[model samples]
Target: MRNINEGENESKRSPQSIVREVIQGGQSVMSADARADARFVESESVIAENILSILCVPLIIKERIAGAIYVDHRQARHLFSQKDLNFLEAFADQAAIAIENARLYEELEEARTRLSLENESLRREVLVEKHLDSVVGQSEAVAKIQFSIRKAASGNSTVLLRGESGSGKGLVARIIHNVSPRRNGPFIKFNCAALPETLAESELFGHEKGAFTGADRRKLGRFELANNGTIFLDEIGKVTLAIQAKLLRVVEDKEFERVGGTQTIKTDVKIIAATNLDIERAIDQGTFREDLYYRLNIIPLVMPPLRDRKDDIPLLAEHFIRKICRDLGIETKHLEPGVLDLFVRYNWPGNIRELEATLHRAIVMSNGDTITRNDFYGLFGDIVPASPDAGPVPMPGSLLNPVIGKMDITSDIYDEVMSSVDRQLIERALESSGGRIREAARRLGLAR
Candidate 1:
């Protein structure tokens, strides 16, 4: 400690400085040396020097020796001892490791700070775009469909969507179109089942002047108007065999002759046809042509029914509820504690459409803000079992009862029948409450 200031100012920073300092100071008690005597070394080293009867040691960091330390006396036959070298080597090894560890720790902290900043930037980007918000649900089926949609949309291909009624095949078609290069073009839709046979041909192909009895002038059909765009042929399986042949020619050759016209009209359109019916079944039944089916099914996309994706039920239900509320100008509604549990438990035959209708009915009938169990089941009439000991039930008299009530009202008794509705409602409300004053008070919003 006494020579530390002068030793730091030394010109040569080699091991000689350490040797000189140790020889001058009595504190240089080196260890780990096997030598019998000590000698003078360089004076510029920041290391311990040999002392007579002391140990010589090696300085190390992380188990790797960087340099050696010497301690004790010099210039004589066996003047210093060997024990000092051993002590110096042990102390140098520990100090070297400590220094290396501290440097590493600082580096690690810097890396962690940089990683945190990168993660924060990624989170902000996701939120700003609202990307994840639009793609909800984690079902493998949904994820697979998303992957396919992205992979198939890179090229311009004719896509066919097939599924059951109420399934979102049309929606899938729109997603494909929106992700494709033709996204900017108009999307046109037509239902083959909605048009009669006589009008279906005229609907798909434009009509010439005086084409039929109702043809007052030339009118463009769906195909002509959908030029340079995408045309969605919904319910494709239902198109007549005659119309199917016509469609095949149009789809294959990109040209069709209008009804009652000789001129061949060419069209530039991307076709995306959708069908709820099974094309194979229609072909087997001789209702649909095989050649037309193959043309429309080039890039087939099948959408599974909603019941198959039970995991997405809650998300889909909530989405429909919000949509219904928005369209109806009604307040937003929430599910009760067990409402979702019970809803998912039931077999949804009508799929998302059924669940959406249920939620709509519940919301419209709900009196209070929160939707409750009673409000959900209020749409249906519940039948109760009679007591075993009770006699056969008898119908009660009521003026408003459709069958027993008087339908013939003259000018004098007209007012009497109209007032019966008010009295019956109050009596029914009291009966449903089991005659409890406080319960009935709450049901009718009467202050207790």
Candidate 2:
């Protein structure tokens, strides 16, 4: 509230003086005649403004003085009595309550909004972890990959995924993005090898309308769409040198301009690039940028090929079986005893993708609830050895005759012969031990 007249005496005559006194003293201040009172006789404002009566009280709430309230009348002396002071004090108490309630309400609203955002972030994180569980492996190599993924997801560094083509680099990239701090943001993927050189720049950096021939409208690029999120660049080694230069700028500066636009647009995105190419070889050949390679190699994660982690074959096969069955709307199928052994023996050149495809094919061709080695007859070719004859050999030396006769002298001849011998020995032990694996292993002098 402003004073009615502006003057040197205005500050002193204003009710603020009384309010301050009341608040500081934590009590009411009532002056029936302020100008005549000893407290104001020496005050220039009290006399010049003809301040006559005043009533002020502290606004206390919850044992704390929130503020003060004051009322005054200039034309009347002895106008404010103890009764009037009591009335103003009561009103002040009610005002303090209203202020505290409003404050509490605002605080509650703020807490609600904060919790809502936190809950949403947690929800996205949960979804991301669930998606990452699909990595599906229990081998040491797989465990290392998973650990690297967790470590990589905790930061904003650029990641370079090195692996064979079908070794699940793309899946690992998605898992990294999903579990990272930027999980809630968009996850945009671009296959660097999918586009031609002429369109690679426009696809990554966008272009304004009429920037080039056949340009009918403005289009946002992968980087722009991936702002404040993650952008996955698959087959990163396939992009041309010219496009690599643009990618380097965005990695180093976090800024870029559309193909035809002069305005520099900023973006906050986490980049994850995957490739099967030997990056060091490419760099040496001048096919890839060295600086960009260093920038992207901040967090390098190598995906293990399926053959290297053959122990996980059974798990992966079962996982894929259940998935394929569900997708095909059929009953889940189980593998025959020898099928797993066959899978372990063959070298899956196409890695996990090939394994999945092989399983899908086998499942589709299967006529019963179980998939046998015959189901994959032509798939593995000569790798699938023929079952031994039903009759027992007259002597142990006779077993070597058939095995030695069928074997070819090659670099892997030792492993091939041992694998066949091991299979035959285990089969004979199991048959003698009533199909008990532990008894069979014990009879074969092998530890369980």
Candidate 3:
């Protein structure tokens, strides 16, 4: 129970000489009466701290002595016996095991951290690859869009993408972000049409706690989150004038206050906006701000409708087939010859999205190894194929045309319109075929 007040000075006072010897030799050393021993009696530690009885034992780790433990009695002679030395050796062995276990645990933790970082890097790489691959075309129209994307990526100018819904406008935006200098920063997207006017403001500019009724906590807005990066505003035409004014500030000055907060937050973000609406028409109608349009239209990029790039239909269809099949955990399916020809002939008013949906339906409805032209019947409902007599092909129209008004029509409207047309055509064919569906299908150039 003797305490060593000068243990801190032992390393500096030449006690390391004896301790190092014991550690190197992997053995114990004892001086039952140090004053009676000439070896350490003259040492500064032994003389200054008063003569002592000492015991030292080596601390071995993995068959090598890393260090040693030394115990001494300040006032007693022969206080430590052979039994005490044996007990200290057993404690040293336990201490070595504890140290080794701690070292191993730290190494394991370091390895785990490295693995986690590697996995995250790999995941981001895969996402970028998947996004790039999904672009899926080599047509002139596609090549032109790719060229514009590359040009846009070279700068941080505000880009306004004008395209029909489902024409992969968002994908183009992401390509710009991934290739730009701000690629390492966050790419935040918010659909202006997804939230109500009240909530849209809160979402775009964030809100302070108690900003309004049911506003329980403060929130960070998309602009704030996308600082030093890119923020994609989908359906930007849907925002109200109030929100437009606030958004214009961000586009022009890169600063805005939260919904109810007085603090002005500055952001360094690139704006990439997409809208199916015609900015010209909207500006004329006073629904959209002219100044805002000018600021966002710095680089206007139009995404071509799928119908214009009919040559890419086969490539896109096959890509979607493989991707959707893999996602559904089903065997890969092929398209029958002439099916792709029919796809090319049909003016996919819904653009790329409609084509993908059509293919998804064909794959889901058909159990065969190949999707034939007949599979489109359950989806497109007797829409006539490539025939000289069926009817003239539906031309791709603009969203500003009052008759078309909106370019992005839903699947339900598409189905309803096609069904009505199909019903009239079927009635005429039935009259010509004595009310036989088989014969009607034949007259309409549809698959039976």
Candidate 4:
């Protein structure tokens, strides 16, 4: 570098010719003058120059040249010394390691992000497969339900599934029918809620020609169509008292006479009834018969509510959001941690159905490419508000009461009483046990 600078500064040859000579060497070091003409751009070590006495060295580790260092000397009558060249080489070595370290750190960060995204995608795919195949969650309560479904599927037991709406009884019934020996046979579904009371009997049992004003020709009922298969009775609780007795006769003897026809038809179809209503209450109120309840409740499966399986909500939410986005013809968006927070805290009165609907609405309503808290604002207000039965609910009132109604602060109430009891019990327990939380927990029957 010193010899090159000495020749160039004296104009022994043009600066352009010196720059070309430097580029001819497949090395890392170069020097240039103040003319700003091309000095170097590394060959095996490409670099730039025009500031003479500028030392450029390649920072290489293994086979990678991480970076280069360019040191400029602007002083007059200055020329590079052998000692300065040696020092510059050492600086280049140190610079190479530092550059390598920084590059390694960036690569590690990029790898971490890539792994996280891959893992998230794999998790999402598993969830979608489960939801699409209808393989539901594995809560202990669900095991009991499955056991009942097995019994109902194997024999001629008429099942009555009791749970809140959206508890997946319909899905459970379908699973039972699909897994049973009758899967190859026809399986039909009927929603009693969507069926009118006057036409429910006709819907259940086909009417003959001219049986009624609309019966212009013969028609097959759900039972006939689903012959030798399974008949899924959804929302069976909505059936009237008359329909209940008729259903009981079919369950007991498998005999039914079509409307305005004397001939009796026998059906080999299995009956799997589902209801979100309390059949016991319906029976007591004369809307359902006790004998029919006994027959159907023989293979009873009681599905648990959403609050009981809180852990499953996060997985289910993501699964449902993906499915909804696909159905809506939109790109899938992930839920931020805040969205999970909102979902976990809000009580799901409508259960899985409610969560699905909320996510579908949010995906459509979101403005940005990513979903955030702003996307869900005001949407969850209904689920998070104070319960109405929590005394009047403080609504905008008429002449009788004001908008901000006074709260009853009675100590006997649930919130205050529980809080007071909790504090006093904790204090007494802690004192007796000398602040040993484990011992205190033992005394109070609490799990540590």
Whole-model Cα lDDT of every candidate shown, in order? 0.65, 0.81, 0.81, 0.68
Q: Write the per-residue lDDT of candidate 1 for residues 37-139, one digit (tens) a residue.
A: 1333332122243222333345555545455565433222344444434445567767777767766765565445334533543453332222223334567
Q: Flag the better candidate by TM-score, 1 or 2.
A: 2
Write the residue-wise lDDT of candidate 4 on 211-323 in tens digits: 98987656567776677888888888888888888788888888888777788899898899899987789878888788888887777888788778777787777777778
Q: What is candidate 4's CA lDDT for residue 161?
A: 80
Top-TM-score structure, candidate number:
2
> All candidates' TM-scores?
0.54, 0.59, 0.58, 0.55
- CA shift of 380, model 2, Å: 1.4
TM-score of 4: 0.55
Summing lDDT over every window of 10 consecutive residues in candidate 2, give the lowest-scoring window: 1-10
The sequence of per-residue lDDT tens digits that candidate 3 reaches over residues 164-263 is 9889897789888888888887777778999899989987888887999987656677787778888899999999999999999999999999999999
Q: Regarding lDDT, does 2 or 4 come out ahead?
A: 2
Comparing 3 with 4 on lDDT, the higher-scoring candidate is 3
Clashing pairs in 2: 32-78
Better of 1 and 4 by TM-score: 4
